[model samples]
Target: MSHSLSRLPTLATAAVAAAIAAAEPAAASRAVQSRTVKINGVELFYREAGPSNAPTVLLLHGFPSSSHMFRNLIPQLSERYHVIAPDYPGFGYTVAPADFSYTFASIADLIDAFTQTIGVRQYTLFVQDYGGPVGFRLAVKHPERLQGLVIQNAVANVEGWSPDAVKQLAPFWKERNTETEKPIRALLTADTTRFQYEHGTTRPQNLSPDAWTMDQAGLDRPGNDAIQLDYFFDYQNNVAAYPAWGEFLKQKQPPTLIVWGRNDPFFTLKGVEYFRNLLPNATVHDYDAGHFALETYGDEIAAETLRFLDTLPDK
Candidate 1:
């Protein structure tokens, strides 16, 4: 009897150890994985996490940023969804060739190709800043592939433009001369890059220096400034397509979630209203953050995103 009782305790301990060993794989699976894939003749570096068969969330980053912008949010969402953030050409570790066209349309095409190359037929798009134009173009091209949209400070409405930015951008938009290029190029400075993450956050101290440092490193790459300038000049094309994007939203009525930082000096609250006008049922959450809301409110955004995804009919 004593032998059996001792054996039972040993068996129980073995089972407990086995259970922990089993759990480790799942825990390890949640860790973000970095990878690179060649798409459209350029090597596109991407961060991926979660199961391949799970509902996918494609994170499209903004200007002066890369997939690094979604670094914190990816792990949070990966627990329940497949999260992928790709660095577009001229950003992050993605290689940008001198001959490559740095227009939003070209970027959109690259992303679309990247998705197809990786076998992501359908997904929820998370867009911010430059991602607005790239993702919207993809949405317009392949409306059937979109499950939903999560827009963060991505503007499509005319009302969303800050007067100060519009005034400053007007001269650059109209002409590409040295005089016009000076102010636009000034925005590429380290101060402006840092300001993007620190400007309107409630707790600037909580912001990481690594965010701006990584972005500045990417921006500082040789010939990257000219690529940025080319894209800046081409931004008008995105503006021109806004009406079409709005029309697509009205026509398809894809489920949407808008999380905006009210203090964002670039795209304002007016842009959220424009989205609401299109996706009247879109859940809106405004934070007291700057352009890079994820820097300060990543947890909040991730929680809200999970909640929103859970409530989706297909998910």
Candidate 2:
């Protein structure tokens, strides 16, 4: 009887251990890693995740934001694909040298070098806000390197500009001066930062305050305002290249997916249609949220992105 009791205890312990193991979720194969690489004399900070051999999705962030914007989406996508989100010069943790030109073209050049240095020869480009200009520049420069495109509130057509945004940015586009900068400076305030995330959401209360808090913190950095202003003024150059970008899209017709926020005040819904007109085969998902759709619909965006990526020819 004693022998049976002892055996029962051992069996029970083994059963409990097995149950515990079963209850616990399997550990993820990889976790997001923050890294920095020297490119063009500046250290570019990037967040990377997923297997090196997996198809890569390069995320380019928008203005007043960084790779931090993709904090949630990276790990989700990394489960099945290699994801890279880099902070351009003058943004995020990237070192901005005084001599570094902050124009979209210059930043694009730096990002191109960054990808080459990191051995990312081919990737699906994910562009948002300021990322649109930078990523488009890369697309035009090396169309062969592009495997696909994922656009989130990124504009490539003049009609992408909201009427209000057009009026507000008129002065800066026409001329860069103290008087013209007044309205642009107003956009740099904390309140405006908060509004950018909360304005178009159905559940403004559900949005995390951290979104604006982190963005405002980045903007408050010394000389960042000047850097942003320079980029804002240089945006006119991007507008001028819209036709070329359109032509590239029409020619390459790379499998494209656009996840847009209908509530975005900056880029109009027309922007999504413009790409659709160019690449009729492109898949598009629209969200009720504003400029930063990922902030609100990250899970949905990640799921849709994975679905869209699966449709592409495997590299």
Per-residue lDDT for 1-315 in model 1, tens only? Answer: 998987998899999999999988767768999899988689999999987888889999998999999989998998988889999899998889777888999999999999999999999999999999999999999998899999999999778989888887889898889999998898898999998898899978669999999999988888888999998999988888999999999999999999999999889899998999899889999999999999999899999999998877663
Count of steric clashes across candidates, in order: 0, 0
Candidate lDDT (C-alpha), each: 0.91, 0.89
Q: Identify the runs in model 2 with alpha carbons over 4 angstroms from their true place.
A: 1-29
lDDT of 2 by residue, 1-315 (tens): 998987998999999999878654322424888999998789889999887888999999997889999999998888888899999887889998899988999999998999999999999999999999999999999998998999999999888899888888987889889998999999899989888898798767658888788889889999899998989898899999999999999988989999999999889899998999999999989999999999888889999999988887976
Q: Say which candidate scores most in lDDT.
A: 1
In model 2, where is the ten-residue run with the lowest total lDDT? 22-31
Which numbered prediction scores highest in TM-score against the true structure? 1
The local lDDT score (0 to 100) that residue 143 gets in candidate 2 is 90
